[model samples]
Structures are given as C-alpha cells and as structure tokens.
Target: MKLLTLNFLTCAIKACKSSPASFPLHPRDVELEIVESDINLPFLKNILPRLMWAELRTIAAELGLPELPETAPTRDHLVEGKEEAKEGEEVDEVPSQTARDLHRVLLETTVKEGKLVCGNCAHEYKVMEGVPNFLLPGHLV
Candidate 1:
C-alpha cells in the first residue's frame, strides 16, 4: 500500500479502534518497491493539507526512506511568491526537493510484503503483493 494510505488505516480490532496507538500501525518486516510516476506538483500541494505530516515522517524513517521534515509545506509555501520568501524559489513554479521526496514516499513507494502491528493491541495485519489485508477473523470482527 502507498504510505499515504497507511495514515488512514487503523487496527481492525473493535476494542482497539478508539485507541490512539492503533492508528498508524507500525510496519514490520517490510519489503519496499519504487514504481516511478510523473510528479504532479499541483496534486502534491493539494494533498499537503490533509496528511498527518509527523506520522508520515516517522513511518518514512522506519521504512528506510529519507526523513521528511517535522513540518510539511504550508499552503502559502505553494503560493506563487510565498515559497521564495522561505525557500528562495516558488514551490509551485519549481517543486523543491522536499516536494519531490513527498511525492516519492507518498505515491511511488509501495509495500510489497509486510505486517503492520497495532502498537496498542499488538494485532498483526499482513500485506502481500501490495495489498494490505485488514480483514480480521470472524471472532474479532
């Protein structure tokens, strides 16, 4: 699954659904693959506001990807001239290395195989062939 998707996932066990640690399940024994695609700067800028930036940065580091800054690009950072004020270049006009890294981590990288374990309940979910099986057994469900 794309790293972005992990941000939305939580442990499937009903008891752990409300637990904070259940969200952003920690990846274990992960196998990563990069499938390149054209970087869409506008899309990146659009989704920036929605991501859990800190959690994403932590997961990226856990997966052996380059670290994302603690702070993500603000909407103003994507504005025509605002980026120059902070980064000395308009990010909308010329995507920065940070933007590129975000694109790569969120879009290009996929987990080919792994298990994501709930930090709270320790429930394990298997990922195979780029698909995460969040389904729990009948008793758990």
Candidate 2:
C-alpha cells in the first residue's frame, strides 16, 4: 500500500481507538517498492492539512527512509509560481521541489510486504502483495 494510505490508518482493534499510540502503525521487516506516477499537485495541496506530520516522520524514520522536515509544508509551498496567462485564460502552477519530494514519499513509496504493529495493543497486521489485511479475528473485533 502507498505511504499515503498509511497516513490515514490506525490500529484496527476497537479497544485501541482511544489511545494516541495506536496511530501510525509501526512497520516491521518491510519490503518497500517505488511505483512512480504523475504527481497531482492539487491532491497534495488538499491532503496537506490532513496529514499527521509527526507520525509520518516517525514512520519514515522507522522504514530507514530519509528524515522528513521538522514541520509540515504549507499548501503555498507546494507551488513554485503561476504561469502568466492571457485574459480569461487558465494559469498553470509550477510544482516546487517541496511538492516533488512530498509526491515521492507519499505516492511513490509502497509497502510490498510487512507487518504493521500497533503500539498500544502490540497486534500485528499483515501486509502482502502491497495490500494490507486489517480484518481482525473475533477476539480482536
């Protein structure tokens, strides 16, 4: 699954819902892959506010990826500048380096195989073939 997906995922156990530690499930023995795609600048801008920056940084560090910035980048930072457009014409915005880096980390990076462990419950969620299995047994449910 894409790192972008992990940003919204938390521990599946119902009991762990109230715990802050349940978020940003820790990756273990991960096999990572990079699947390149065109960056949607608008999507990145829209998702910026929803990201748990600190948790994302922790996940990246745990996965041995490069350290993220101390603070999250603002939507304005994602664009370099707008191209001059004629009257009544649409202007194009150029994506900045910050946008590119964000795209690389959130969209390109994938977890091919791994275990996402909950910090609160210590439950392990299996990820196989780039798909995460979050279904819990009756006890966990």
lDDT of each: 0.82, 0.90
The lowest-lDDT stretch of 10 consecutive residues in candidate 2 is 82-91
Candidate 2: which stretches are off by over 4 Å? 81-92, 139-141
Q: What's the lDDT of the predicted structure labeled candidate 1?
A: 0.82
| Candidate 1 lDDT, 1-141, residue by residue in tens | 888889798888888988888878889899998989998878988898789888888788888887777788775554445545665543437666667777899999988999999989998899999899988786565
- Return the top candidate by TM-score: 2
lDDT of 2: 0.90
Give TM-scores for every candidate, taking all chains together and pairing residue i with residue i. 0.86, 0.87
Native-to-model Cα distance after best TM-score fit, residue 49 in candidate 1, in Å: 1.3
Cα displacement (Å) at residue 132, model 2: 0.9
Tens digits of per-residue lDDT for model 2 on 11-33?
Answer: 98888989999998999999999
